[model samples]
Target: MNQEDQELQTEKKGNKVLVVGASGLIGISAIEAFLDAGWIVVGASRRKPILLSGRTLEHIKVDLLNKEDVFKTFQKYKDITHVVYAALYEKPNDLVAGWSDEEQIKINDQMLRNVIEPLIAVGAPLKHVSILQGTKAYGVHLHPINIPARESDPRDNHPNFYFDQQDYISEAGIKHGFHWTVLRPQLVTGKIAGALNILPAIGVYAAIRKEKGESFSFPGGPSFVWELADADLVGQVLLWSATSPNAADEIFNVTNGDVFEWRSVWPALAKTLDVQTGVDHSFSMAAYIEENKDVWAKVVEKYGLLNHDLNAFIGQGHAHADFAFAYGAPQGPVAFVSTIKLRQAGFFKVIDTRDALTEALQSFIDRKLLPPSIA
Candidate 1:
């Protein structure tokens, strides 16, 4: 077999994994990756996700915030040997404001505890647990982060759900005789739609601009260098964390191994979306998307796309996109996080950022969530 085939071929280790937040970007990617690697995957979320590949996904609807519901629902899955806690709770109307909110921290902490405590109580054979964090852990949202932030960097002096969840999992891992890994991924992009992922929001914006015969202008302020982690790559790392001895009870900062400015990549992104790039025009993605509901509906009809309305189609992605693009800011800090820790742990996989993003957008188009790029 060829090297590519060899790399893709993974031995099934007789593992059953429960993936929470199955509808979000990280969750969707982890599900597909685990299934491809020959693991029995059970997905859980409040809403059932539509797999982009149209594969049958075994799913359970459970709210992580509802402790009793989560506990009762998970009690039957005592056979689960692994868990990927990719679920998140964000303020729907004011996504950014919730970051520092005490209630947000409490809710997120409870969510993690709710899921894992029940599993432990039921005596599930959980060998490893994987959890997700982001650049926010480095205080990128509140202050400038250290250039090339390392996994060993001092914890940002901020009240964050990440800290609460990490402490809980670490103590539990020791007491419950299971391993845990914390992964901090930078600007994750993937195929899942109508969630917090930015790709779908960008695709819809481009399609709307195309429909209006306008250029897909850069809608943010001064550009800043940034890194990205492919959701698929993050999924693979999750797999590696489960079995790699080096990953047990460790934290990793994951990225695509390169960086790019938004302005530098705008042309390529626009080309991939079948739109022409225009001069930078600073604006808020959230506001723009909110104002273009009817236009998006018209685009959906024109393209024979899924009939989800703009709000349902965008989810909280508009706000996330605005944050990611540094909208309305005169300048933004260059945020880079080191992945050398992950590489040293022996999972040295990487993807070109341009290809990773373009391919993700193409997947959305193939899934009928975005209009055709060719047309």
Candidate 2:
């Protein structure tokens, strides 16, 4: 067996975990990873997740914003030993604009506190807590980030819940004698529909283009290097952080260990979806996806795919895609972050961006969540 496999084999099993935001990409990936590793998993979210690979994840419906509800719900799970806080709240209608909103910051901070404080109060044997942050923490949204943003870089003073939650967790860790790891990944890709992961939105866009008998063109503005984090890889890191000494109380920036320019990677994406790639055809993916819902429905019906209504299936993904693709911008931002710390810390996992995107897109097609590419 490989060293990592051996390590997983030796690790203790049957530790119960509470995965908040069970319906999201990272949460679903983490749940699957934990279950496969023999961890007793319970998921928390307002919406129960569909059965994962036929494994029925024990789920609890609770709103993280409702403090009393969160406390009441969590108090019952006294045996919970680990927490993966992957829940996120994005403004539904005005997704990007709300990122810097004070109310957004407050709500996110409270959500983290509501979940963790209650678990601590109920005296759950919380060994470790892992929460997520993204490129936004480095103020990438407002301005250019350091070429390769490092975790040790000075905080980009911003109106972000990441800071508030980090401060809260750091203090809590010291006070309660627990370990916490913060992961900041760039462009997380996964198969979950209606989550921030951009793969599904891309799938829908491809399906729509193929259905219209149009070439799969690069719809963004300019070429720029970008990084990606596979949801499964993020899950593995979460598992690593749960017990690895290197991960204890550490903040790590993670990616697929390589970079790709959208224009360069376009062919691979097109090949995976069996579509023909065209030259740069810059347009708003956010606007296009929003405008093509009826077309998506027809594609779904024609291909005998699942009924993933555009808005529900795409979530804020179209908007996130625009952000990732740098649509409507003069040039794409060079948003690369340092994963050296992550590697030096002993988690030596990596996946190519092309393969990562291929695997993610194929997953939806295999599940029939998205239509197969046009012949």
Per-residue CA lDDT of model 2 for 150-223, tens digit only, reads 99999998889899999999999999988999999888887677867778888888888988898899888777
Compute the lDDT of residue 350 as modeled in candidate 1.
89
**How well does each candidate superpose onto the true structure, as a TM-score?**
0.95, 0.95
| Clashing residue pairs in candidate 1 (N, C-alpha, C atoms within 3 angstroms) | none
Q: After superposition, how far is residue 126 of candidate 2 from its true place, in Å?
A: 1.5
Runs of candidate 1 exceeding 4 Å displacement:
1-12
lDDT assessment of candidate 1: 0.87
Count of steric clashes across candidates, in order: 0, 0
lDDT of 1 by residue, 168-221 (tens): 999999999999999999988877766788888898899888888888998887
- lDDT at position 1, candidate 2: 92
What Cα-based lDDT does every candidate model obtain?
0.87, 0.86
